[model samples]
Target: MTQQHRTALKELQKLDSRIHEARQRIAEFDPRFEEVEEPALVLEGELNTTRNRLKEMKLEERRLESSTVDRRDRLRRLEERLGSVRNLREEAAVSAELDMVRRSLQNDEQEALGLIDQLGKAEQRLGELEEAHAEALRVLEPRREALIAERADARSELERLEGERSVFAQGMNPDELRIYNAIRGGGRRAAVAELTEDGACGNCFGIVPLQHQNEVRHGQSLIRCEACGVILAAPEPGSAADAAPAEASTAVTEVAVASDDDDGGDEEE
Candidate 1:
């Protein structure tokens, strides 16, 4: 590949970097959106509980009404039986049953009243909870919409960048683009790096042979740092003399990173 191809690859890598960061930004809004709606969620839960309790209480009220009617009918029957008793003993027995039935009926009436009162209160509470939930949602709408719009904007930008990247890649040499993609597949940032000031691999800082440095800076074919396997490119003009002298070594290190697993280096300044 030519120097121009490496420069284009670096530009493409920069675009990909932005895309990665945009995805992360979009993901971050999930928690924030949940937080914004939490108040409404809590209120909604209470409203449902209150409504269910009211339903159960109304059923209980109906049951009590039916039991009251049955108890009244038994009381009438016992009163008639008392009048037609065979003797005083039978009359006393009927009277005792009448008293018990009256007590039970009274208890049921009292319980029914209490249940009605509780149902009224629960219904009121439910209304209040519903109102609060609506209000919570209303209060949160602006912020929620803002977050949504912001994330949408980020996504749009990401789409635009991706489209641009696709078009840019279409015009690039397929082999070089494939190599760049393979180098970046492992999530390393730098797909291609410049040769450092003193003939060292910029990515790993490995001392490159003078011959390799010359070819990377001046020739057209791809040259990787064998130690880390990062594609090397030509350094920027006037950078060599200005860069601080770095420590160098001639010991050759084994290539720990394969082509597909190799990471890219930091962006060039």
Candidate 2:
């Protein structure tokens, strides 16, 4: 009965591993979704920036027109005063002021005309960008919908597996299930592993004491690998399936460590 329960836990662990991978597959879609949306995002940003600039330019144009109006009123007042100047001195002073006001009004009118031209060009550019943005969204809709559908399918599979795990865990030995869940919590992936054929921990390659190895092989009680704390189940008879876990992890870790050392050396140089 204990052995049977241990086998159930191992099988549940395998199912959990599959669930983890399915989740990872679903997560991988996020980057692809972002990739597909990037062009539209860029265009939308440009559209917003251009629209804001257009608003500011229009405000500036209105301000210039208001200034032009005030200057026009001042020029009219000065010209009327010129005809009524009391002496040559007064007339000369009025004439000088009139020339200054006239030049200012002319400059304002020229600036307003230049801005009106710019406003026309800006409006045209905005129209072109709007059309392009609309076209991009139209072209992107199909691909984006396809990605959404694909991710939905992956999520559906994950839900099915989770339901299966929930159902499968019922009626198990409570103590054993509790232990399994505790070890599996917090994104820890390797909660249960089989003993390698040579009495070593499959997870970390540490040699299991002969006594514990015997207990694990016989499925006496749940024996955890002291080196890595993964629950040890017996490997399938006459199989090398557990042989590579430690080796593969070790190789990858070694390569990563070597790369780090090389980077450190370059930094030192």
Question: Best by TM-score, which number?
Answer: 2
Task: Note the residue pairs that clash in candidate 2.
Answer: none
Off by over 4 Å in 2: 238-269
**Residue-by-residue lDDT tens digits, candidate 1, 9-123:** 7678778888888889888989999999999888988888888899999899989999999999999999999889999989889999999999999899889889988988998
lDDT of 2 by residue, 160-233 (tens): 99999987787566677788899888557888887766678878889999899777766567799998888887
- Model 1 C-alpha lDDT versus the unseen true structure: 0.77
The CA lDDT of each predicted structure is 0.77, 0.78
Error of 2 at 253 (Å): 34
| Candidate 1 lDDT score at position 79 | 94
